[model samples]
Target: MHGPEPGPGEGMGRAVLRGGSVLAAGTLVERLARFARNVVLARIIAPDQFGLMAIVLAAIALFEALTEVGVSQAVIQNRRGHTPEFLNVAWWINVVRGVAIFAIAAPLSPLIADFYGEPALGPVLAVAFSTMVFTGLMSPKVYALQRQFRFGASVAITQGSGLLGTALTLVLGVLWQNVWALVLGTVFEAFVRFVLSFLLCPIRPTFRIDRESWRDLFAFTKGMFGLAFMTFVVAQADVFVLGRLVSAETLGLYAMAVTLAMFPLTLFSKVVQPLVVPILAAFQDTPDALRATYLRLERLIWLFGLPMAATMAVAAAPLLTLVYGPPYAAAAAPFAVIGVYTVVYMASMVSFSVYLAMARPELQRSFTLLRALLLVVSIYPLSLTYGPVGASSAMLGALVLAMVLQVANLRRIIGLRARAYLGTLGGGLVAAALVGALTAALGLLNLPVLTLAGLSVVPLLAVWGLLLFRERHEVRALRRRGGGAAASDR
Candidate 1:
């Protein structure tokens, strides 16, 4: 079996364990900080205020997404990705994109605000969107770290900057008690991230352009731009559509649910997605090794994700009410549905990264386009009928369809059969079933809300322990022989 030749300190299993721990720990801390910030801010600020800020963020995301040029992906995937000329060219292109987004968004904010019937959104959006400029100026060397599997600096820059931003947001939220806290906090986080990028990487990009460099960078952007745009539409369509359909207070409740449901996905985005490209790129030349590694990762994601989905689907209402108070409990239903959606979404993410490693971003674009179209077609009608639940359901439907397309693409490209794909999900399904059964049985005891949630996950945890016990031999083998060799041996 052809396999990735693990270099010193770069065994596939070892790299995943080491890098995953850094990214996961950093992301967990950052997410917890943000969660604390939200819990505090939600109490201080009214629902309508959060709704207004959500609109502001959605508009800013739209403008920035339009200009996304896949610079980071390019830097990671290209052979000359770390060269000074290539990095410089990437910086210039991104800076130009950022400036353009700001200029257009600032002027258009008034019209966007008018559409949403919140005239105050105009200024808030203009200020929040300036983050595009800051992010554009960030050093491309951050992506270079991933290419080399060096994650410590990247995690430090991300979590350290994020913690600072969270603290600032909390301070301002206490003082202001309004939507400005959310807007300003977001802008601050971007600015800090940009500054820290330079400090950690210490690579100053000059105003230099090269034809070959531009060609290499822009080559990846073709499908990336489309994929990015489609992803934005899928990501923000619920808020964008529901803001117009429902009251601001209702929209706020829905937005809160989205945050809660997306908790798992947020970690996936920060940790797994970033690692996918560089890790998989190592096996790009060997289809068997690529497929094997991809399946193993997907299986691991499902093992955890499925149980999380089960807990969210069964216990989200009680959990939300327990943590955020009764005022936000209205978010629970949508949270439950969206939580299950996370599994499908994360599974697709693994495949998406595989496609990128193979330089087949167009495939990613195609599936995302399918999702965008589904969302656009279904969101309005669903929101009109079922309110936030319907809106969340619309997104779930769209993503499910897109994931189906992705499975088909995986088969054609890597020869991953449907049966093999289904097999990876089996353990997760069993764990999810155990959680559901345990939750159902626990409901008979008249437990307190939080206690019920706490008990509901017990079976899931046991299942995880059992799975780990079963894998002990493989774990030891990996430690002895290295991850790539051990995996290929299996």
Candidate 2:
């Protein structure tokens, strides 16, 4: 018999470990600074400023998502990505796209403000849309770094941007005591990120646009845009509904709650998702290998994500009360409900890289569109009775539906059975359930929020340790050999 062949992604685990640590450490520092910034800003600025900022942001994202050309994903997935011609063309297309968004969003700011019934929003959006222009100028080399797992520079740039933005926002918020700090701070972050991307990425892109490259790149973007738009809608549905129906104060409170609750989601976006896509792309041609990779990441991420959700959910009331102080005390109930919602929301994100890896982005598009439309139908009616809490529930329901569809889609794509999926993730489910239960029980003890939350995650850590120990072999394979099959399988 042949000696063990090389495992998929062998020897890449060291890179992943290095990259993950860089991203995680930087992200943790960035997040802590941001939390402090939020604490200071929340006190200085009124809730209306946050509500205004959210709407402006949501609008800008809507336009940007609509115009996305899949330039980044194409670079990551395409073989020609390293060629100067491809990078230049993708860069130009994105630059034009960004400019177009700014042009349209700037003039249309008044209409958006009108739609939201907030006159002050018009000016805030005008400044906020400037970020899109700089955002377009970022080098595609960032994707190259991700594809190769050379995230050190990219992580530094991101952390730097976060720190700069937080500091600027704090200073400006204190001085202006309005939304100018938030809006301009965003633009500052975008400007700094673009500068850093060019410096970090080894690619020296030029002005030339290659015809075939544009066609190939646009082809991918055509498929991706619908999915991006639907995702935007799903993500911003609460803002869309509540911005119209609720008070600014109410929207601000809900924003704080969701921000606190979406910690796992933020971490997934900032670190996990980017790494997974490139790694998954490596295994795409081999179905068995792909399925193995998906299950391992899925199960492991579930174990890690479940506890954060449980802790945040159980501790939302006091977390909000403690973090933002008494002014936001009224936000606790909606915060709790949305906390639970966010944990379940994570289910939708699990298979995203799998779908993209399999070149089935349209599946994500269709399912997300279904979810968004369903939310539109459900949210208005729900908000009529349940208020912002009702809107959160509706959005969560959409997420659940989307997740079920993702599982079915994954089955069709890879022949992985649902029973196998359930079996693999059942431990995570149980751990999360136990954490939630214990948190609720301990919450009755009337401890401080930090103390209560700290206590809540103890069982999570224990369960996680037990799972890690049980799966030490596979875990070791993931850590030592990279994110693929077990060492024995090689």
TM-score of each: 0.94, 0.92
Candidate 1 lDDT by residue in tens digits, 206-232: 666788988877778775876787889
- Which pairs clash inside model 1? none
Error of 2 at 337 (Å): 3.8
Clash count of each predicted structure: 0, 0
Instruction: Candidate 1: give its CA RMSD in angstroms.
Output: 3.6
**Model 1 regions more than 4 Å off:** 1-13, 472-490
Worst 10 residues of 2 by lDDT: 1-10
Tell me the tens digit of each residue's lDDT in model 2 across 1-490.
1112234444567667677778888888888898889888888799988988888888988998787757788877775665678888888887888898898889998899999888988888888999999999888777756665667887878889889988998999999988888998989999999888888775566666798888878777777877778778888888888898898888887787678777667876777777777667766777777787778877876776676567766676666766786667677666766766665565556577776665656667878888989898998999878888888888888888878777888888887888877766676677788878877898789887667756766766776778778888876665542445323222
Q: After superposition, how far is residue 217 of candidate 1 from its true place, in Å?
A: 1.1
Error of 1 at 386 (Å): 0.4
